[model samples]
Target chain A: MLTGWGRTSPTAATLCAVHDEADVVDAVGAATPERGILARGLGRSYGDSAQDAGGIVLDMTTMSGFTRDGSTLRAQAGASLDDVLRAIVPEGYFVPVTPGTRFVTVGGATAADIHGKNHHVEGSFGAHVRRMRVVTGTGEVVECAPGSDAFAATVGGMGLTGVITEAQVDLLPIATSRMRVDTERHADLDALMAAMTQGDHQYRYSVAWVDSLSPAGRGVLTRGDHASLADLPAGTDDPLAYDPRPRLGAPPWMPSGALNRASTRAFNEAWFRRAPRERRGEITSIPAFFHPLDGVRHWNRVYGPRGFLQYQFVVPDDASALVGLALQRLREAGAPSFLTVLKRFGPGHDAPLSFPMQGWTLAADIPARIPALRDVLDALDGEVIAAGGRHYLAKDSRMSAQTLSAGYPQLARWRAMRDALDPRGVFASDQARRLGLTLGSAP
Target chain B: MINAVGQAQSVLVLGGGSEIAGAILRALPAARLQRVVLAGRRSSVMEERAAELRGRGIADVETVDFDARDTASHGAIIDAAFDAGDIDIVLLAFGVLGDQEALESDPAAAVDLVTANYVGAVSVGLHVARRLRQQGHGRLVVLSSVAGDRARRANYIYGSSKAGLDAFAQGLGDALAGSGASVLVVRPGFVRTTMTQGMSEAPFATDADAVAAIVVAALAKGRETVYAPAVLRPVMAAIKALPRGVFRRLPG
Candidate 1:
């Protein structure tokens, strides 16, 4: 919920609908844009990452526009990750680093400059963005390349400079959607990180699902990458083109129906044990491997009416000591995340405004009510910043702007470029205003 | 033919409550759509529209206050949006369709109508133009109407107001030609909505949903001028090019 331009409402803004990028763009252009606008995705971000409270917001998902040239893929701002995979994987290419799900738009990916499990090895999605076609505050549609300062600024700028209409994204060659995954149970947080660090180079993507319920440091470490054709059984056809449509239906958001102590525990136990012991071979479609959770759409609604908050934070490796501390806080507060992801992060990009850095990033989707969730997150945000790390603008829905300032050290520099490019500040979101992430206060 | 795959885009309708614009947001697929913020005078109304979007998976929905007549804060409004992130499209969809009878009954109401529809829009439009021109790219979709084609005694005030807006948008569109930015003028017939409660339906009168479909098409094509009824483009031409004295004698 958004009150006045930057004001917040007690109720949360829920994603109850799907939109086309073209329509969203038209709607924004629908008006004369007397005040300008910003694009939002998922509403998963807490502050204003996706909201320009008082102004117009270019809902790009309507663009649902897509095309492919050689290995390069392009899509309208509104195209979601699921949309992208559905279109290309059958043709043998895969999106770089899809987050836990495939419901996000490409524009949101670029604006927030999101990163995923493979961040330590592949960097942020911005790294793979070859060129972006943007609609500025003034209504000019300009093209920005990776080398362009504007692109660098806008990529991680979180839609502060202009709206990204479409982009020429570099795609990767994929043999199949199936991933040859390896799962190992870790005793605590340290073992998980050690496992991730050692296993990162061995795969294109790696992730760990932490058992936030276990005492301080316990969790499950999962690692995988697209298995090369050589790793698959000798087939007579192009295995990459193997279209894996859903055989059985996944449950919808059942309002606390799918997630609970018994169900979550069972699912986690099954997930950890069922992973094939023989990492030697597996065959599946792109959707099954890269975006398994995507099979169940509107999963957020599963958190029930109370809603959910995704508190994602990154801290330097030295901050590992804080892992047990964090777990203690979450447990003491009796806050358990329904879904938690842990990954080892590498040094952040020189974009002057990127989110990932040389550290570890953990993201958790917890019910809105954990008594100490807010305070715990605040403390984590503090520790992460003290360790020279930052939080992801995409998944965050809670961290204070001050913590954000401390986390993203380049906030000031990025804001300068944002102001220089858009001095009028025509593109502000609810998160930015709440965190006071304006030009003056940036890093 | 408009290549839509992988092309992520965002569109923010300032007055998302506008039936014409809201219809447009509805036509787009929810997956590709990013955020739809409906900024208007009524928070409840805006919230309702945002809820409609969320129902469609366009979850990044928001609502904020924006008085079309509020001139002093236009820059802050624009700056606020810019700071949120980058903006690709800005739709200045705020206006008043005041009743002609009411305007005549209270002359002050007439002033409010003009200020909200024409004067206020112009002030905000100028701010939008300058900012978009500076950013170097974007599109401004302005809602002009078939009434803007030619003013008649039936609704001269609202018609003339639209006429002024039509002219402004055309000029703005021209000014941004090579700047990678453009303007789209929407001219639709008497739409069947709350705005036309008392008036008899006109030829080819469409619902908000239909109007939105045409607008989406126009935006994708980046068309300079869009006639809502589609047939209105040609029909309005003959009406506007009509001899004024003769035209006035037969109407109303």
Candidate 2:
């Protein structure tokens, strides 16, 4: 399997097309006598974290079954976030802490312990998870819940914990389908951070979009929160049930040249300007707010013939300066990203490789062909490490194994848990090997 | 951006189901080859080849739709493979051997042969070359032939096609200088494969396995050019060193 987007081109490979859950279980059963079994979700992960380079890859996203318990939802590993959101949101409950897209699976979310715009208020999804079912390397099926070592080990464990066949996620109680968002514009970087810190507290949910293409020292920040039921105006009351007008996709295999620097820069300007200037109290749906980007099926194709590399880094609150510094370096290096998002992270949960903490996380997507791109990112990795921060494993495509080890100090403990559960090293992945997240060689 | 440093990597065989490509992949270090991809016209064959590679310790095997004659999509095809993961190397071994009599009878068929053997490869080579340049490192191993050194009426159609390929590969190697990437040109005379099922063989002709060994060795050294059977090198040198009249009279 080639890299997702963010690179200039695709790589080739020989692969197994596992169509269903039985394929996953069988693949797990056939692994070489060692290691734990971590299931693979969609290949959206930039790095090899989701890929089993030389091991059995249990592609369980194909599993089809779902049972809802009031606000608590239980779906198979193959069930996608979009599937859950669509199935449950209309019933008056919403999944907590969705990432940028909804194509990700429930199993993937637990494995990566994904977080989102509401992270500052709700923490990560791992925190809301009630329980998980995993298949061990020895072919034993086990169950775990929050506070259990297995629970902590499984969530954000990057699939190293076990193959999450099904997960119980705590959904939020919703008043309506639309979110009454109040987006405020920030003239500068400091103003943006100021808006995020103060405004996030007032709203149950929050997110911001920055003009990453802005001059090194200047940028725009758009902040928002969930709309209150009272915010609805003269329109009919049931905005939740109102299906959004869908847009058609590009015909077929569109060229990468469509998403050039000029177009992206222009889009950024319009998005920053038209962010409902002054929080006009517009009624927006859940998909628009949570998974605004999910509309474009293979949006990565926009990057063109050159795929892109996504770099997401979190710097502990102590090193806020590094955020601005890193952007400046990008400008100076002429390596600007097409999209950059900034979010506030609450206290991190238990996953060793999970990417969250009480700090600011900024994510950017850049085409892979840019000269010196790797060097610039490598240097940035050092800065984040110096600040006691680390990179997000899900969005990482090029981090070295050494960097992974150095960034995640608790890796040994995680490894110990993984080994205890899967001594022979049954569960393995290309991402784990590439970044040294798995048990390496013999040791 | 991929740091292949200590991790096992992947290799792509452009010609799916090519006996030669399969042979080469089998001989490479199993630990280093995490995955293998066979790109060709029929996915069925690509699948068969992928299985073969996977059996040789390449647990990750894949097949992509690729048509040599359809050169328009070469860039996307090669780039797509690299994007899947880090394609450590790309082995371009897709080619055809048309009958000299058919080529002599029909110029149209000869042109198709020319496009398949040279034009299609040139397009893919250039497209893959740009990617290799961008990734900062990769390998491009193309299969050429001794016939390319000097064209003869005996097989001018195939000889000229190789002539074009050989030149292109050499130039690509030079273009990649200092880019941390290079092209390895393989000039193997005759290999008993589907392409030459009924060919007449001369002395020093080797099989796919023998060609695989020489090509792999040549690659490990980052050599500019190589000849199968080792003796072919000296033999070709002496041939090129011969008088023009004598060279043309010799069997191609």
Candidate 3:
């Protein structure tokens, strides 16, 4: 049985770990239409996007290997960002974009087109890729560059276009691993939005943690940029040293209702109260600023066996009000969400299926056991569609096919390109079937 | 495939006219169901069941002829259903509950009942298992009865037939262990359906909808065996352990 990070919708697949490009070619060659094939990385995708039911799941983790050439890092698809960071950070380089966690593989990051806190200043992960080697469904290895249609289709195509074996990505040169941070607490959604809009350009990275359960939608805004060596304390030794490991591990099992309304409310309240009202120029490690959640291993288990759904949607800048409306609706519906993050995306890339747009995106984690969750999310889907927004396919497990078509207008075009790349339709996944991504003719 | 919330997109009911099978289909999340195939003997009852599913928002409702007594045709009937689409759930609910006293004297009727209830099931069960294994993922729900737990004097003929079926299903489940296909043997007590309408209510008697609810929950949890109303598991155990002499003396 295989499941995404959400641990929901588990399906059985024939797992074949491919250690090289030849193994990938052989695996793709053996795929049958009755039960197609899909590529799986670190399994960090929150939903079924990484899983194929009754099909061949090519586990690419074993193929992890990379080489550094100046500021360009060429990594195999299976090499995780954690591995990339450890290798590059000490050498004064960092990934151009990273999501909330460093456990994501290079292929997953590119396929999902993950965005980071710096999305307002930088673009998604796909924008940094110079070239990639992909094994098409026909068992042919093709190298695609940025301007090629295959490159656009392969990036954020959810691995449907083909199996990406390796990628050459441009890296960000950094002076030190430490980050110069600024923090502030906003009274309500309006204040938070206003503050972010007015001052986000000054920092390379920006993000806000919202209290969805709070009526005012109060939140904490944090912004930072890579600190220079001179900014470190006078006696600091090995300023570029980077070592990140899980400081703690979540319990193996937790009761289903452990994150109920009352407990989450109290936790959110305490979390809000603990933040300093206004702080600036605070020194923090790279892990502390970007991937704090990674400090605890298997933290998703905190929601217990029922698991949780991370609903993330991005509306155009003009439809920013939908972000506040979503939070208010969840609160009114009595849906308890523990972690809610709000970020601003600069501009989307050429990838048709890429999720990021020049807009505001909010992500909230809601327990699946909540009775009102389905209705609330469905209603939110309607509102998001009306506001010209789309949910992130990487984090989606329950959205409908109609919603996906309405949100991504280029879906038809992407399908056409994908069909040309894999006419036999060997690349398939549970999400592809759920959202009708690999169904029907392109037109 | 079953979705994250445990809703199946398509279901195939071998015994389409069986009230328990209809109830199970109705009990599923209607909004999530795209297709429902009813395979049973051609009759207005099967058509009515198909109409009911269409009314419940299932866009595709198909009915195909299936004859339990004609074991030779089981493979063709099952193949047609699977060929239509990937069936997420297949319900094997066909069986005969014959009158024991009448069957004892009528040799032909006894043989017919055994062939329909046991022999026909084995044939259809194996066919469905093979397809499910080839497809790599699907759940086959076999509706056995509490009578199968042990043979009693009152309905030993029917009980003995179900006993054979129950064992066959259990063995089939073991064979498909790692094949991504599974068998859910549901041992329901007397259910208030057309088949048992006029009969006296047995201990732990349940309605078809109640049996359906139990079966649906068991499917979600991926359990190998389930007893409708749940209490029948312990009751059947005690009844099986009862001394044969004492059991024969108990009031029917």
Candidate 4:
């Protein structure tokens, strides 16, 4: 059985770990029309985008390899960002863009075109990609660059165009693995948005964690930049040091309802109160500043047996009111979200289906068993669609096809490119099927 | 493959014209379903049903000749359906609720009911199970009935055949446990299909649509066994626990 991290909807599939492009080609060739194929990397995608039941799921993790020359890095699609970081951090290099979690494979990041806290400054992960080798549906390997249609489609096409094997990406040079950080607390939604909009450009990375359960929308805003050697304390040893490991984890058998409204609200209050009203130049480790959640293993399992939903939607910068209205709606419905993150996006990548745009993206985790969950999300979908905003496909388990099309206006162009590359409809997944992405002619 | 939101990509219904199975097919999220194959004795009538599904937005529909009594050809028919592509689900919806009085009076008729409902079901069920196990993932929905709970004099022949089928399905489910294939045995009491149209309403008689709803829900939950109208579960449990003499005295 293959289930996304959300664990809400599980389906069965024939999972095979492919070691190279030849293995991928053979696997794709062996699949019958009904048993389509999909490429999975690290399984970090929060929804069914990585699962293809009753079909062939090529686990790309086995194809992992990493090589570097100067500042350019060539990593296999299956190599996790963490793997690349460990290899290059000591050499004064880091990935140009890193998501909240470093566990994502290079291929998965390319497929989702993931953005991070520094999206306003560095753009999405795909922006730094120089070239990629993809195994098309026809069992042919093609090297594509930024201007190629296959490159654009496969970048955020969710592996529909083909299987990404490896990519050549530009790396960022850094003096140290530590981050110079600043922290602040906001009492309400208005204050938080005002601070972010007016001053976010001054920092390389900025993100805010909001307490949705609080009517006042109290939150903690954190901003950081890679520390320079001069910024580090004197007599520092191994300033470029990088170690990634989990300090704690939830047991495998946690009971359901552990993240109910009361518990979540309490956790949120404590987290918000702990943040200093104003603090600057705090030297924090790279992981501590970018991926605090990664310190805990299986943190998602904390939501419990029934699993949870991570709803992330983005609207244009001008329509920021919708963000406040959304918080109000969730609060009014008494919907409890365990975690809420707000980030500013600078621009989108060339991939037609790339999620980020020049806007504010809010992501929250709501328990699946909430009584008003479906209805509240459906209403929010309507509002998001009306505001010309779209939900992220990587984090979605349930979004109507209508809403999907409404949000991604470039879908038709993407589909045309996908059809040209995969006319036999060989590359498929549950998400593609759910949103009619494989239909090729859905209105 | 069934999509995350519960839409099956392909379905093969053994008794293509079975009203209950048709209802379940309609209840599926049709937009994501690419193909559906209906196998039944009368290909013409099955073709009509296929057309109805196409009208209902199920993109592709195919009908194959399948006669439950022709056990020799069952393997070929099932293999051909699977050869077409991976089948997400196979509904074993074909069976007969023959006239009890006629079945009892005629030895040949009694043998036919036993063969069609018992021997034929086991033969095709095993064939479908083999294909499902090979594919590594699929669902088999077997329509058993409450008549199998305790044999009744009014329909002993039919009840006995169903009893054998129910046991076969349960055992098949166990066999496919680690193979990623599963079986759902649906025990609906006197579902009002064309087969039971003229019969007097059994105590808790229900229609095909209701049974279809239960089957759909069970498929989603990956349930091993289910009783339609649910109340029949306890009712049948009590009936099975009664003394032989007490069970023999109960009315139809």
Off by over 4 Å in 2: A5-25, A33-38, A216-222, A234-237, A242-246, A251-258, A440-443, B1-252
Q: How accurate locally is residue B208 in candidate 4, as Cα lDDT from 0 to 100?
A: 85
Task: State the lDDT of candidate 3 residue by residue for A103-163, as single tens digits.
Answer: 9999999999899999999899999999999999899999999988899999999999999
Name the docking class for model 4. Answer: acceptable
Docking class of 3: acceptable
| iRMSD for every model | 16.4, 10.3, 2.3, 4.0
lDDT of 3 by residue, B39-150 (tens): 8888888999998888877888999888888889988888888887778899999988988899999989999999988998999999999888876678999999889998
Q: Write the per-residue lDDT of candidate 2 for residues A255-281, one digit (tens) a residue.
A: 645665677788878877776446556
Candidate 2 chain B lowest-lDDT run of ten? B1-10
RMSD of each: 16.1, 13.5, 2.3, 4.2
- Name the top lDDT candidate: 3
lDDT of 2 at B92: 90
Structural RMSD, model 2: 13.5
Residue A402 lDDT in model 2? 59
Model 1 Cα lDDT, one tens digit per residue, A365-393: 66653334555666677776777667777
- Sorting all predicted structures by TM-score, with the top scorer first, yields 3, 4, 2, 1
A383: Cα error in model 2, Å: 1.1
DockQ of 2: 0.05
**Chain A TM-score from candidate 4:** 0.98
**lDDT of all predictions, in order shown?**
0.67, 0.72, 0.89, 0.86
